[model samples]
Target: SQQGEEDPQALSIQEGENATMNCSYKTSINNLQWYRQNSGRGLVHLILIRSNEREKHSGRLRVTLDTSKKSSSLLITASRAADTASYFCATDAYTSGTYKYIFGTGTRLKVLA
Candidate 1:
């Protein structure tokens, strides 16, 4: 599949702790993006890193990409209970002469108050 794979399908942590999620893809991609989805709601874009970018930060979120390894990671610092949600990594890949956006399985995170 062209979609990426995220490690640690589920995670539980206390508020103020950090949550880290890793994603690994199989093929070349133009860019990678992270998203968060609350229960029964649509996904919200968190960050996007191009293939040329190595690292990026936005507020409490940190993202790193390693094209050599075809891997990426998302780190949420000082996580709060409101951060409980499922995270997904998406990539735009060229497939069958067309570019398609594929999403990873996902990582479910639960933050305790």
Candidate 2:
């Protein structure tokens, strides 16, 4: 599979703290996108940075891409309890037509109040 795998299946942090997670994939990709899923909620798009880009930030979240190494990292600063959720990395292999994103197994993050 051309999917990525995230380290540390789960994480716990206090409110107003920071959280970091890493992902590694097997295939080359055009872009990578980060998503958040709160419990039973749908996945919400967080940010997406293309292969040519090294880093991108959205609000309190920051994402770094290293295409040469087939790896990516996500950093959330000053995390709040509300930030508790599962985070996933989805990648599109720069393919045409039928190809879709392959999502990582995800990292479950718990932010303590």
Candidate 3:
């Protein structure tokens, strides 16, 4: 079941400026991941921040997880028009020795040229 909510719901940013969005969840998770979906196509995994880790970075993408606050944030630096997409946060939970990914409502990001 999806138990997370992404703030802003929609965002618009100019090229070169960084974009930041947040995801807040309920329940314990083994890991939290950020993904980008272009026009509802398959998702492209952006970053995964484990419960034990506070922050991680890949290329121009940065993710931060605050388990204490049950929230996570994704930051994209130097954005481009291609970066425009819907971003989702999925919580990985383990139960009965099986792992399940619960995705939250996405944040629509429009990167203008």
Candidate 4:
């Protein structure tokens, strides 16, 4: 499958703490992206790291990619209660002359106030 798998399916942390999530995929990809989703809502694109990029950051979010390991990690620094959400990793794969996205199961994060 082209889908990635996220580790530590769930996480709980206090406000101001940091949360980290990891994802691993089975196939080569052009890029990997991280997304956040509130309950009963659609995903919010957070960051994208291309295969040639080792790391990228936006606001308090940090993303890392390791093509050699087919893995990626997302870190949210100084998290807030509002940061509580499900995080997912998606990869862009070209198959059968079409581009398809495979999303990981997701990591549920809970930030306590």
Candidate 5:
């Protein structure tokens, strides 16, 4: 399992602040994706970055990947209480001759109002 692990297992910040999370994996991946889950709801795809790309942005979200370091980071700017949720990093990697999508232990973020 090439499952990644998110740093700072939990985070808390005031609304309107910025939040950042980091993920590290053990294997090579073709691409990395970030997902957000609101409470018990399903995961919502936020951003994806291929190994060939260094950084990508969508709205208030920014994602950066460093294949050489087998790591990735997600940043949310001007975060709101509505942004309080669990953030996960998934990786698509070819392992044991099979391509697999693996998710990491998520980071629980709390944006206090």
Candidate 6:
């Protein structure tokens, strides 16, 4: 099963703060992707890094991967109330022959206005 389990399940922070979330998976994967879902909106792809990559960054978002430990972390810098939403990590197992993605429970982030 290609599942990434995220801890806490919820988070709250004041504006201009930072948020961090961790994800751990069970099996090997080709690549990992982070997505953000804002309320009723569709999921937006934040970033994707392959297994060979150790870390990647995009704007205020940072992601790190440790294949040895089968874990990863996502960091959001200078968080704003606008950033209030749910973050999820997904794993893609190309070798598993399943094109579907398995998402974590997700972390509901509430950034105080």
The RMSD of every model to the true structure, in order and in angstroms, is 1.5, 1.4, 0.9, 1.2, 1.7, 1.7
Question: Can you write out model 5's per-residue Cα lDDT over 87-111, one digit (the tens) per residue?
Answer: 9999986859898779999999999
Residue 79, candidate 5: alpha-carbon lDDT? 98
lDDT of 4 by residue, 7-62 (tens): 87999999999999999998889999999999959999899999999999999999
Pick out the ten consecutive residues of candidate 5 with the lowest summed lDDT. Answer: 92-101
CA displacement after TM-score superposition, residue 100 of candidate 1 (Å) = 2.6
Off by over 4 Å in 5: 95-98
lDDT minimum window of 10 residues, candidate 3? 1-10
Error of 5 at 87 (Å): 0.3
lDDT of each: 0.95, 0.91, 0.93, 0.94, 0.93, 0.91
Model 3 error, position 94 (Å)? 1.4
TM-score of each: 0.93, 0.93, 0.96, 0.95, 0.93, 0.92
Q: Which model is ahead, 1 or 2, in terms of lDDT?
A: 1
Worst 10 residues of 2 by lDDT: 92-101
Tell me the tens digit of each residue's lDDT in model 6 across 34-73.
Answer: 9999995899999998999999999999999999999999
Q: What tens-digit string does per-residue lDDT give for candidate 3 at 75-109?
A: 99999999999999999878799998999999999
Off by over 4 Å in 3: none
Instruction: Mark the 10 consecutive residues where model 6 has the least summed lDDT.
Output: 92-101
Residue 13 lDDT, candidate 6, scale 0-100: 91
Report the Cα lDDT for residue 54, model 4. 100
Task: Count the clashes in each prediction.
Answer: 0, 0, 0, 0, 0, 0
lDDT of 2 by residue, 43-74 (tens): 99999999999999999999999998999999
Q: Write the per-residue lDDT of candidate 1 for residues 66-96, one digit (tens) a residue.
A: 9999999999999999999999999997869
Could you tell me the C-alpha RMSD of candidate 4 in Å?
Answer: 1.2
